[model samples]
Target: MRLILVNDVSTVRGGATKVALQCLEASKDAGLTCAILVGDDGEGLKPQFAGIRTVALGERPLRDGPTFTDVFAKNYNRRAFEAMEGLLQESEEETVVHVHGWSQILSPSIFYALAKHEVKVIVTAHDFFLNCPNGGLINFHSGDVCHIKPLSAACLATNCDKRNYFHKLWRFRRTLTQWGVGEEFWSRVGIVLVHEEMEAYLRYGPLRHFTTLRTPTAPLTPGPVEVWRNRRIVFLGRMCWEKGVRTLADALNKTGRTATLIGRGPLLVEMQRALPHCFVPGWLSDEEVARLAGEARVFIMPSRMPEPYGLVAAEALMSGIPVIVSSSALIATEVANNGAGLVFDSGDAASLADQLAATDDDDLMRRLSEAAFSLGQRIAPSRAEWARRMVDIYMGRSSFSAL
Candidate 1:
């Protein structure tokens, strides 16, 4: 069996990329031919997949465009779709095309090509772009989840996140184009993989055509307790509006607990202003972030948007730190179910403060910490296990039995 893993980037650093790489590894272990196609060449791209055969689509077009829309569309047109088509045709039959991310680098054109070639396709919903225009299903300016269907004009007109009518209209136009093209080509997709149950919420809406596969994630386990300390909280991932940095700041202010905000995003200045007591460490190497996670008392994922999965939260749990997250976050649900973390009200700083206050009990913290370690072992998919699963899928096996 042969499998082709398609993504906008080849780096295995992020959650989606990790999943893709795991699949590639799984494919190879299962005695299947595996190849990767990336949309661009970057420092992280090639090195991360050193031993694997990879094809980089070079730099995407319109990268220098001033507006987000212009740059996004240009890259989609120039790289994603074209590369997918070229790679698909060059590969042999019975190939499983596993797609991870596509919005920024690849346009809707790749779906059409897949449809034309009669290839078997499986798309993993790492985020919400398949059903929402903004991809996160988040209103950018407001940091709120978009409950409305992306196919609706109301969703387009509301300019949900940008809060600008004109910008909303512009977004709507682009989304409409993408949606129409996708519907025409992707309606026949064989499967859609989601990490949690919350993804089912989207099935009844606009993306009802595809079959849903709910895959479980493994949790993180901390190395040692020597670095652990009390009253030190950590925030990981992008510091953007959807991540609820403002809300996290408010919670910190209420609790008077200082936090280390690791990761970079568009809302750095705003987060700094709102939480003067908090430290912004910027983007750190995975090793650095893991080290910091070990030192922290607790990790918080205050995202207002629906997190498809909370890789950072898992890391925190693995590091023996408790995690506090919003109920809307899928990762939070997993954490709560595993008894490894606490869940707060979505977008409510007060609720987060309450959860934090409750964590002062050392016994409770210890119990949660232990649970986190156990859950981490269960949730964080090993490189070998992921590889085996991909091979099963490529071989037309009904389940990832080896996983």
Candidate 2:
């Protein structure tokens, strides 16, 4: 089988890029002819694989925020469109095109090309961009998660775009285009969700017609869970609105629990001011993050939004540190099911404080720690096993066998 992976970045950058590379590497290991196409913005669009082929489309638009370029090319990256048309039609084999992300750099035009080529396609819903115009299913103006039907009259009226309404209008037009893309693509191929809770029917009731598979992203196993000292709570990722930073600060303050905010973002200064004793240690390398997480008594992922896949929670489990994730995060289901940790309401400070208070329960912490370590092995498998499962899906042999 020929596996063609596509994404916005070529190198390992964010979660989507890492996921694309992992699947590409795994597909190649399964003896499939694997190739990847990326929007090479001078980072060389090169991955670290030996025999796999890498195709680099030209650089993406230089503009970042509001611009005429964003309106025109953010949803219709022309260079990527031309490149995909050439690549898809070049192969006549039973090629399966697995698209990881496109809204950021590659745009939705490649879906049109896929429609033109009639290739077998599978879109992994890394985020809500495929369905929600604002990409986060969030109202940027209000900082609230959106529950209105996508593209419905309510969705059209709400200014959910991150920037101004003009920008919202731009995204509105782009998302309309993507909706067209989704309308066509969903009829032809499969949709791979990272978690079972991410079922599309929950969001779009009619989307139940699609053949969807739930395959959580492979997790990373840290060194064996060891006894450590830092009893303070830890928040490891960026300090942003969607991460429930303000709500976390309130919880920490209410519970009077010492904690460390490990990354930087817009709320850092404000959070530091509110919690004078909370450690704000900017950012750290992966090794440092692992060490800190390993030592912490509990790791927290208090996301306000409906997080599609919560990798940090899984990483925390791998470190043998029990997780306290917002109930809205998809991984919370996994952790709660395995008795690995606690789940609080998404944006409720008091709910989070209750969980924070439970962290001090020595017997509860001990039980969670032991359960968390076992759950880690189930969540993060060896790379080879990941490859085999992926191949099984591509070959139509299974639908994400349960853990």
Candidate 3:
């Protein structure tokens, strides 16, 4: 089978890109012809997929309009859909299009083309962009989950996160238009893959017509490194409001436990001011982050949102480190089920502090650490297995399965 993966960026900047690259590697292992189509090119990402064929859509100008209330919202690069249209025309009959992220890159035009060609298309819900305009279903200003349905007047009336009520209204209008166009084209999607069961619930509850698949992830290894001193607790992901960085910092301050923050985001300044016990190393190389994980005592994921798969949590578990996650995080379910970690009340600093204190018990930590390592083996599907499953679905050998 010939497979083509589409995403917004070529770099492994986020979980979606990481999973997409992993899938590409898995497909190659399965002896399928694979290629990647991306909207942006960056030096940090170029070497990650050295031998892979990648096509970058030419840069285009930003849309001319009134800027959103939040300046960050204006940092969007409009994508040229025509490039993707041309690419699909040259694809073979056996081609399977796997779309990861597309809100900022491939527009609705690509879906339209795929529908017209009757191409087998699979879209992974890496985030909530399809259903929510903000992509995170988070109010930018207040750092809260959005409960309103997509394209609803409530979503339009209240600026969920972008801080500008007018922009929220504009986004709602755009979402409505895109949904109409998407439904017309994507109603025939071969499958919709999600990383977690919680996402499946949300998708089925909102968009029930599509088939869903749940495939959790494991850690990436660069061999093993010598363990270091210091009872380090690491937080490794985007440093954003939705991630509950402030909450994590608050917990550390309240508990008097030192931590290392290992990612960059919009709230670094605030985090630094709030938590003196925390060390912000900014963004580090994957190698550095993995090395730190091996040395750390525990990985803390304080996300207030429903994290789909929690790749960081899996990685920490695979490295034999216990994880402490917010109860609301979807990965917390996996951690609790697998005995890999402990869960605290979501967004509660006191609860997180209490959980931290409990980790000091060596016996409990040892038990959880062993469970974490074992669970890693079960969750991390081999690349070959992932590829086989993809092929089976593409070849119509497996019946439609819902997550």
Best by lDDT: 2
Question: Which regions of candidate 3 fall more than 4 Å away from where they truly are?
Answer: 42-54, 60-79, 141-143, 182-184, 199-201, 204-230
Candidate 3 minimal-lDDT segment of 10 residues: 61-70
Over 1-403, each residue of candidate 1 has an lDDT whose tens digit, in order, gives 5688887766544577767666665666666676777766733445545666677766542222335555456424645566677778775756788888776565666665676677767778777667666667777766666777665767756667444667556545655655565554555554455564545645633344443343435333337342234666788888777788888888889888888998776778778777777788678886676666666777889989888777777666666677889987877767898788799998999999999888877788888888877777666556555544455555666542111
Displacement of residue 89 (Cα, Å) in model 3 is 1.4
Ordered by TM-score, highest first, the candidates read: 2, 3, 1
How large an RMSD does model 3 have?
4.1
Instruction: Quote each prediction's TM-score.
Output: 0.84, 0.87, 0.85
lDDT assessment of candidate 2: 0.73
lDDT of 2 by residue, 228-305 (tens): 344868897767788888889999888788888888776778888888878877777877776666668888899877
- Give lDDT for model 1: 0.68
Model 2 vs truth, CA RMSD? 3.4
RMSD (Å) per prediction: 3.9, 3.4, 4.1
TM-score of 2: 0.87
Ranking by lDDT: 2, 3, 1
Q: lDDT: which is higher, 1 or 3?
A: 3
